[model samples]
Target: MLKELDLARREAEVSSLAQAEQDELAELREWLAAPEGAKDEHRRIAGLRAEVKEWQETYKKEKASWMRAICELTKQRDLQVSRADLFAKQLGQWRDIFQETDLTNLEQEWDPESSFYANEDAERRECQP
Candidate 1:
């Protein structure tokens, strides 16, 4: 009877050790799976951050280009207005000369197609600056 009891105790101890080993293996599996699952999430977040940074840099460059274009256009527009003003002043001087000259003599001396007014209009239309 005593020998049977010792055998049973030994069997129970072995079963307990096996159960403890299984529990430790389960904990290790859970820890291993956790790192594997988290790796994908970490990589995805890193990719998103990189994309956002690229977009931010693109926007900054675009905004700077837009500002430069706007400034150039403003300068061109100012120059055009100044040219128009100078043309108007010259026209006024030409009109005064026309009024002072004798019409019959002017007709003989000047061709209508060769007038300053016609040339000025053509030049203004041709020259963007």
Candidate 2:
């Protein structure tokens, strides 16, 4: 009777161990099937990575647009500066011509082909429509 009880205890221990292993395997399978379905660490990290990628793409597009705007503004500013310089030079020439002539003298002769007036025809044609 003692030997039989010892054998029965061994068998029960073996069955308990097997049941524990089977339970562990089932839990592993369920975990694998729904790893992303749960709000676990893996899911949170994946969501963060996707959000970071979207922000990076958006930043790249916005940076490109900002650089283009800066380039356009720089070009416009350069054009205006050059135009102002050209107008200043023309104004200086006209001022010199004015200083040389006496507007109050009635007998003074005005020659259209001399001084600032000589380039007026060509300059008028250069002005765009």
Candidate 3:
């Protein structure tokens, strides 16, 4: 009687273990068959992120180049404006110097008395009929 009871208990334990293994295998198969795109989604998201990073880098470089060009152009424009102002100031100074010289007064001060009749008048008077 004892031998028979021990054999039956061992057989039940084996059957339960086999059933548990089958359940575990069935759960694994169901998980594999489900439509989960986690791996693919991860790859796609990573690709999109890389593209965004590249675009951002390109934009930054272009922006920096544009800023540099603007700065250089501004400097050139300022230099041109400064040169024009200096030229105008020099022209004003020259005008002031010419005004001070007063050429009209000089001409009047050096006028000759009977300026056009000195030798000519003497010759005409000596040859009068």
Candidate 4:
């Protein structure tokens, strides 16, 4: 439309009109390519979003793995602490029992010919008869 309008008004300036038409065509081509360039930019934005989503998913997976590992370690540590506490209580009781026992009297009583053993044997014989 512009070319035809300009041609009708500028019959005497053919060369100048031709140059103006070429310049207008170049401007129109650039305008037409704008949407296509925007489409390429949109594609690049979509690709970047996809990459970000992939990285976020990987981070979530790794965080979950680390949480599981920490939970497992905590459970193991608790179990070990409980076992150690139980062992400590049992050892304390054994130590108390050992400290209360008279090792010298126990050894003497263990001898068969000791007077305490003889007295026990006499009591047994009397009970049997």
User: How do these models rank on TM-score, best leading?
Assistant: 4, 3, 2, 1
Local distance difference test, per candidate? Answer: 0.78, 0.76, 0.76, 0.76
Quote model 4's TM-score: 0.55
Residue 41 lDDT, candidate 3, scale 0-100: 62
Q: Which regions of candidate 3 deviate over 4 angstroms?
A: 1-36, 105-129
Off by over 4 Å in 1: 1-36, 104-129
Using TM-score as the measure, the top candidate is 4
Residue ranges of candidate 2 with Cα displaced over 4 Å: 1-39, 107-129
Using lDDT as the yardstick, the better of models 1 and 3 is 1
Q: Tens digits of per-residue lDDT for model 1 on 1-129?
A: 547856986797689669868865775566567777876775576578569768966986797688679879999999999999999999999999988987776557877668999899889889977
lDDT for each residue of candidate 2 in 91-118, tens digit (9 for 90 to 100)? 9999999999877864466666775866
Instruction: Write down the worst ten-residue block by lDDT for model 3.
Output: 37-46
Evaluated against the true structure, the overall lDDT of model 3 is 0.76
Over 4 Å off, model 4: 1-34, 107-129
1-129: candidate 3 lDDT, tens digit per residue: 547856986797689669868865775566567568754665565578569768966986797688679879999999999999999999999999998886877776764655676768778889999
The TM-score of candidate 1 is 0.49
Task: Pick out the ten consecutive residues of candidate 4 with the lowest summed lDDT.
Answer: 5-14
TM-scores for all predictions: 0.49, 0.51, 0.52, 0.55
